[model samples]
Target: MGYSPTHFKSINPYNEEIVCEVPMHTKEEARQIVQNSQEAYINEWINTNYEQRAKLLNAVAKEMKDNLDYYALPMTEEMGKPINEARGEVNKAAWAAEHYASFAEEYLKTEYIESDATESYVQYLPLGVTLGVLPWNAPFWLAFRYLAPALMSGNTCIMKHDSHTPLCALRIVEAFTKVGFPTNVVQNLMVGHSLLEDVIRHEYVMGVSLTGSSKAGAAVGAIAGSEIKPVVLELGGSDPAIILADTQDLEKAADVVVLSRYINAGQSCIAAKRIIVEEPIYEKFIDLLKERFEKLKLGDPKDESTTIGPIARRELVEEMHEQVDKSVAAGARLVLGGQRLDDMQGFFFPVTILADVEPGMVVSCQETFGPIASIIKVKDEEEAIKIANATDYGLGGSVWTGDVEKGKKLASRIVTGQVSINGIVKSDPRLPSGGVKKSGLGKELGPHGIKMFVNTQQVWVGPVKS
Candidate 1:
């Protein structure tokens, strides 16, 4: 491959070896892609009926399922997610594609309004090319979450995936092409962050959907807003897992809490970052969590036995360590595994746990995107709720309790995009997921997701006189 100054080199987080390099598209090439997507939207995609779109979407899903093993490799290599978890991410993406394909028609059906003079109704119409700015963590799942819904709504897309995972990003575009999507229908632009503003402000691009840091969101949102274009942002999250006083299943709760926190090495936006346990069961939960943390094996992501893997990059590992250090200095007790594994070749950090974690500490207030569990002791359910909602983020939170009704009540009180009762907060194809406050702007998934880039046009008939 030809090397350019703008080419992105993918590095394996497991071994710190160079995987491959992908050349960045020039400004002219990026403009052409956007224009081509707009043409596709106007000429063919928008005119196609829901049945035709659904057929193609389902075909894409089938292709993904057939090549699950093939696709999971790149994801695991580039991002250090466990091989099994990478495969699971592919499966979830395929499921999302099929889910949107099966339900888009019903979700977008015209709504009839009764009137005295004449008939009136509302119909969902397709917008033009949408710009998807996706992140590297769970690369396939995050892109598909927006791609499936955007395509199902008859809108074409131009994706600007994370710079670190160019190979995985290209494979995503290839999947659509392999499934018989026309050229430019779902294009991936291998470009740098400098070009993001130009793409978002392009005349042909109608909307923007992003999943990234709050800083990135603010930059993109500003451009989209200036152009009077709609933008959906899924930004940073410091999610909390509340363990109530009456939670009877401490073992089960501990298991879920550990899995939710350390899965994807805690890089996920919705990972359980803060563990808030009531005073009565606080010590019990902490002991159980400590045991669970001790059992995690940090090694090669490709190893099926490895529960914790390296962070996606060295910079992230450094940042996580800094947070841990500052939090420790601020009086958070380092219960276990607070040091980085300097002997390891790759970006491996220990499954660290900080006890007596309280407000004002770095781990408690900031979004730490690594396998560091910060446990906070709460006086009661009210304090748990208060602590959970203390952060500026309101992405996803959960309540653990044996009483389902009580859990639901507490979940409702927490100000977040989505909450779980007796379970972990996760993105589902059947449910709407997004956030409020600084967390994000709009929703994704469910019927609401498919409509994010569409226009709700009202059709009115002429009055008929008697």
Candidate 2:
């Protein structure tokens, strides 16, 4: 009936210091939590009116704003995100909450159908409890992205956050509680990874949403599938940034590409992993990128002046280094930083840039989740599009060109979920975000996201005259 004393420590990636030790919930505790959530969904949340749901969502947003620094600081400490970027993530989460609150009514409105019956319509109804398996990167934003939409659509959620960021997970639950959500409407289950399948298979859980690696997605997808439960996956992406020869300003293009490739030390799933440039401007683009990489200051993430921070974990640093080493061995030229910073105390990897990258190289072909940029040269727009589509992951991509129409046209040809023209690829509350192929299975954000876990029921009445 109670949780065990087992616990896990949240280690600061910058200094390897223990930020906090959190108790892990036992299997029974987790099961009870899920049951409580289900009961709350069936008894209270389902009957809660849309107006009241919108108000609660807005209150959560206000709570996030009121305690922005409190939430942002722990995120940076638990994950290696730069403090400034962490702050931005907090703001983004608040915006998502508010965005859903403002538009849920319109998005979930009933649709009337013309038929022989006297009255017929389709209604969007909640599907009870949803399980969200969240990742550590952008901890707050990723969790809130799904939480806001699910709650606004009248479904309760039980989140199983990454083990490495327990503090961040607890903080989110606290925020919900502060907003005066009904008891058990939103809860956090701090359990080990092995218990995830049990939670997924629980009878009361109707849906599951995950934001993590491709491998994790596959495993969870299989589990959710076996039970005939609906799932939404936002997985890994080796997204490409294509630069055409027709670009008017090379400087602007280079700036956008650099930020997209290296933000959050390049741990993002949608970060520009592959940089495909037209042959005419390849050399110029590489030089500009190199200059930008050199300008980045790798230091403590807590420092506001630091632009680049350490990879989140020690094993990730080794993995990223291995990728760089193997790529160089396979003939990819390292133009800038390619080695880990030995002098630093934590897992600090420098801003690395690789040129002459080819298809078979690890850097070009795989999802390199670090501060490393792979530059692939192509002959023309045809080759650019060809190379961009040559990956298994198709989450997101971007096109850089002077002509907006040309960029949009090229974006249409890219095989991905979403694409941006002359701008960094990012998820917006106004549009649906997710991937095609192996990147992800379902969409998130926008109206589609709020409806992902809802059931569409049809209502009909016969005519009085026979």
Candidate 3:
């Protein structure tokens, strides 16, 4: 444990309650664990077969499902994610584990080609122990994301999760052990920010991947880069969601926008922070989205009836409130929600709507990172295109329209890592997920996600004599 007479306290963000005492990991402990992992990888795990590892993955998924009730409560209690969402996040982690299990053998198969001098082929090899620096927004999913791809690729992982969701972080370690994974492979370090550099700089650490703020991502990438190690970072996104005038359903568009904007209490990096609508249906879209925002149920995360929960930390909630306050002061209208939920603790705020948000307005320019929505109107498809591409972000974007061809065309034109034509941005086992511009380096969570951790080597031999 980290806290002492001299250390810090971890609190429940929902009720202003002191949740637990956190541990500050001394550099020695971090180094020892990293050394242990390095030793473990060399002595016991480096040559582990995919089939055996695959079984463990399947078991991990099953264990998560069987223990869903066990996992959901801590997520709600520690992180204040609504019970439904907390459960959903847990389930997705399980799904990612099993998804990799199902295809890892096939995915890792070596490629062989005929040659005269000898045989030529390529095989996936483990990259030793990986360091996963994850955010609290989707604690379990982020940890499992790195573990799933790393373990299946024959690598071990060490997870350094966000401070706010510490309990969920430990449970991730438990999940693997419960599913029969060896000790120390999926290690969870309960440490302070002061110790981050210690973990990243450890001699045994081979690579790093993080999903968090740009500052943190950049810092970690620098350290890993200086060591000549690769880092895959899924940083913040001011992702755009565009609704076309020609789209068939206005109400449906509004519904999807609300959910996308506020999922995880509006904490998702990829959640559609910018809603750019085509002029013809813009009025209707705004009206419905504004109205719908009023009806969302908020409160106890354990209450399955609740749709939104408190923001994860007091400081984050305060910062988000300030962002909204600035937006409204600078001329954005507070259409739906604009202040704290009068009776809650930690940090609870109203679901806000801001209109008349110009390019530099607080809501328009910044990643609000909360349950606030900003509706930007566009006179035509061309204008919508311009507004969506205005930001430096190119992680994800969505284009909605009844014309599938037009949707596809718009999707192609958007300079992002991925675009969902009529749905939400998602990390799938089949498709590559990540971003193009400032979103960070490379992709994760599919074959691409798995490949990022392995060294792809080609064996070349002279072609057969003709």
Q: For all the candidates, what are their Cα RMSDs to the real structure?
A: 1.8, 2.4, 2.1
TM-score of each: 0.97, 0.97, 0.95
- Residues 91-208, model 1: lDDT tens digits: 9999999998899989999999976547889999888899999998989999999999899888999889888888888888888889888778999888777777888889889999
- lDDT score at residue 357, model 1, on the 0-100 scale: 95
Candidate 2 per-residue lDDT, tens place, 331-351, comes to: 999999986688887788889
Candidate lDDT (C-alpha), each: 0.90, 0.90, 0.81
Worst 10 residues of 2 by lDDT: 1-10
Candidate 1: C-alpha lDDT? 0.90
lDDT of 3 by residue, 1-466 (tens): 1244333455676776766556756778878889878887998788788888889888988888898978877778877889888888889988898889888878878989666646788877888989898887887877788889888888888888777677777777888888778877778776777788878888778889988877777888898888898789888888889899898877887888888887888988788888988777877888999888888988877788888888877677778888888988888877777867657644687788887677778777777788888888888888888888888777898988999899999888887888988788776666778876677777888777888888888787766565
How high is the lDDT of residue 267 in model 3?
85
Badly placed stretches (over 4 Å) of model 3 are 1-9, 113-117, 461-466
Q: Candidate 1 regions off by >4 Å?
A: 1-5, 464-466
